[model samples]
Target: MAAIHRLERTQNIPIDLEQAWNFFSRPGNLEKITPAYMRFRITSPPVARMYAGEVITYFIRPLLGIPLAWMTEITHVQEGRYFVDEQKKGPYALWHHQHHFEAVPGGIKMTDIVHYQLPLGFLGTLAGKLFVNRQLEDIFAYRREAIEQLFGSMN
Candidate 1:
């Protein structure tokens, strides 16, 4: 079995907690922050808000323009605080992502914590070391820039 890997990132957005929560809590807003090359799209019908046990599906061409159907279930939610999503079916052997929101000095602090395990045992470890980690890094970098664009830099 491959070891589980973790990635965490935190950023401040110049927005009120309610605004941040309102935007992030809506599942449809995801594609706006995702990179275009990934070709991310939600397959599930529009949801006004996300709640525990909600299952969301998406079609993403994250790697070679080959579409992959990914499904995630919202496992936990605390209004205006945080929410957790876990992969029900996806590329990773395991994927648990948590989005945290907290009110800070001037705006809201958003933190993302992701835990994932690749498949294929030793090969997965090798792949992680070789390029998977870098790919993840790039994805997060794009997300950072996209968020900055949407709300302007933290002021």
Candidate 2:
């Protein structure tokens, strides 16, 4: 089965779209917001900025004591407004994520949309029921808190 999840967060950063984009589009900034438990890293050669077709690799623990190597490619880019990354190889059967940003009255509104499917058919279903779904939510929640701390409040 296919599942699509979305999370939207608006931040009152007192910055314009360009400023927001510059900070977010840099490759290394990911380490600032990502949870330390994931041990997220960019395996690709260091680049000053991000653009479409760039590939990033990371090491994560998806389950109890199971380390997974994940790689994703930036498939779409629209400068400051949005970007998309799809999984090239990972624990998921499929993963496509879109990160969008728009200038709002106070600051910038950001949204994350993720569409994914797990492998192993029935086993995947069981995993989702038992743990994966909750784990995903927790991960995103951590991201949300981190972003707020980094950029300030949306309200």
Candidate 3:
């Protein structure tokens, strides 16, 4: 089995923890914040609120023209603080992401920690070396910029 690969990023947003959490935790708001290139869509039934056990499905093309269907379940939650989601079905052999928010000097500090493992054994490692890793980085970079635009200056 391949070892889990982890990626973490932190950003300070100019808003209180409650405001940040309220915005980030909403389900419908995902499409507003995600990059356009990814074509992210929620396939699960629409819900008025999100909580642990809620399943979210998305369709994305991680590579050139290859549409991948992914699904994850909200596995844990702590109101206005943190939440964890684990992949039920996705490109990865395993995927678990934890989102945390904490009160900071001017506003709030948000952190994203993703732990995942690719499939296809050694081939997955080679793929990551070739392009997946860079693509993933770019995707997140776009997300960060989008969030900055949405919430205002973090600097």
Clashes of each: 0, 0, 0
lDDT of 2 by residue, 1-155 (tens): 54544444434555679988988887677888777777777777877778889998877765665678989999999988999999999988888888888888888887788877878888887887788878888877787788778777756
Q: List the global CA lDDT of all models.
A: 0.92, 0.79, 0.86
lDDT of 1 by residue, 56-110 (tens): 9999997789999999999999999999999999989999999999999889999
Error of 2 at 44 (Å): 1.3
Q: In model 1, which range of ten residues has the least summed lDDT?
A: 146-155
Higher lDDT: candidate 2 or 3?
Answer: 3
| Pick by TM-score: 1 or 3, better one | 1
Whole-model lDDT, candidate 3? Answer: 0.86
Ordered list by TM-score, greatest first? 1, 3, 2
TM-score to native of every candidate shown: 0.96, 0.89, 0.94
* Segments of candidate 1 deviating more than 4 angstroms: none
Question: On a 0 to 1 TM-score scale, where does candidate 2 land against the true structure?
Answer: 0.89
Assess candidate 1 and give its lDDT: 0.92
Give the TM-score comparing model 1 with the true structure, all chains together.
0.96
